[model samples]
Target: MWHLYQFPLCPFSRKVRLALGEKGVSFEMLREHPWEARDEFFAFNPAGRTPVLHHGPKGITLIDSQAICEYFEETVDKSPLILGTAANRAEIRRLVALFDENFFADVTLPLLHERMKKRLVLRAPPDSKLLRQAMRLAHEHLDYIDWLVDNRRWLAGAQLSLADLTAAAQISVVDYLGGVDWSGHEGSHGWYRVIKSRPSFRPLLSEKMEGIAPPSQYADVNA
Candidate 1:
């Protein structure tokens, strides 16, 4: 069986989880506290981040959620979610970068970790000023998504790809904290309603923090 080291609330880790579920692959889930930076965890990936995939066959570790997802989709022939052509792959990669870069840095990280870090005292609190800037920037990113969603069913394209999974993971985390401006961006709002409504999204929605109660809709899948 494969092993995935992840945290309870990291969006990057959720990306890998969604990919695994979409492929119907079962694996062991090991919860890791990334802030502590344990030596055993570092042995798997020097970056010392969560969501590291360990393939039992090769006993090798893969860092980065996107890399792990692509590896599984490419090497495992069961159900490939990747695009057939190089051009399609480029678009997928672009969408992934859009989420990992601007969406994450601007929206999820700031709203959750910054304004709400007090709820999770385990890690060092995020910078206050950066958090403020992140909130402003996130609205701009959401505005961009609103425009894109006006055209396509999915964030990247017509098919439900890892790009949707990527955005779902990020947005879901914030949704848990009641951060999304659900009424402002109808396109994005509708898209998330579908993505989060999926059967694969169940486990993510079911997740709950020790002292934190996700808004009632966090588990609704339809919300």
Candidate 2:
């Protein structure tokens, strides 16, 4: 069985989880509070990040969400969530990379570090500058998504590839923080509602921060 080192809250970890579900791979969760850095888990990943997968060889550790997801896609079965075509593969990778780099760098991380982290861990709120920047970047990112959903059934196009999972995972994190103004875009919200309703996405929607009540629609995958 594949062993996954993950926390319930990390979006990076969550992406891998979604990918695993899309690929129909079964994995055992080895939950970790990576900040504490136990020697056992630390030994597996020197970087101390979540979504580290142990597969095949006992000691081989899979690091980075994209790398792990692509490796599995290449090596495993399940109808090729991606493609053998260069153009198609590049498009999927481009969206995946964009969501990780552009969206997370400009939007998601700032909000997560500034707002959600403090709320979840009972720490003082982060800088207002961070929140302002995150809010601006977040809205910009969502507008781009609204256009994509308006133009295509999924991010990057149809056929339910890693592109969709990548965007969904990113959006899920924002939803958890109530950072998403779902009512702003009926189409994106409706698309998300459908994605959330999927069996794989059901587990993601159910995730809640400790001591924090998510919005009513959080678990209402159909909503």
Candidate 3:
């Protein structure tokens, strides 16, 4: 009986959704447009962000994707998303930070602001210059991911961790905007394909935003 307020395209929200699905936790998803700053939503989370979770069993509300996912890991204890020994956990957390902070800062946020948030929420024209910059940075981020997957089985290491879900959540949003050029990044593309094929990822792949058509390959695991 968990309730999650989330925007379909928001990476942070998507990350939590992926985590919940991967862990076999069922919850109700309430679509919220945070830009509207609804008062009811604010009552639940003062920060007014999506991906806020209401844990029915404990009657506690959780804000922030990182906190919610970690709390689920600690409470659920079924499928281990963040696995391995202390050192391995450290590495996994490092990569999680890399994508959640570094990748989003350089690529996801900027691109979404220009291509999505501006037009859909703000009702403003896209910034061409910023869009171009974000596109370039997106490719660089992809290259970095290619390098990482080239070395490790997953983003962090052999086991599938939060790092993989975190990175995929962000990248999938960008890919929906046609920002990802998956032609050359063979390693990363293959890794993504594997993740995309998972049953947990099916719901996300089926999502289609209003007035925004994703690329043909956006939902294709074999693409």
For 1-223, candidate 2 gives per-residue lDDT tens digits of 7898887767888888988887789898877777667898778778877779987666677998988988889888884667748898898899898988888888778777776667666488678887777777777777878898899877777777887788888888877766777657777787778778878887867766676677776677666
lDDT for model 1 comes to 0.79
> What are the TM-scores, per candidate, against the unseen true structure?
0.90, 0.90, 0.95
Error of 2 at 25 (Å): 0.8
Worst 10 residues of 1 by lDDT: 114-123
Error of 3 at 95 (Å): 1.2
Error of 2 at 170 (Å): 1.1
Q: Which candidate has the top score in TM-score? A: 3
Q: Which has the greatest lDDT?
A: 3
User: Which of candidates 2 and 3 is the stronger one according to lDDT?
Assistant: 3
lDDT of 1 at 54: 86
Give the distance in Å from residue 107's predicted Cα in candidate 1 to where it truly belongs.
1.6
Task: List clashing residue pairs in candidate 3.
Answer: none
Output the lDDT of residue 63, model 3: 94
Name the lDDT value of residue 195 in candidate 3.
Answer: 92
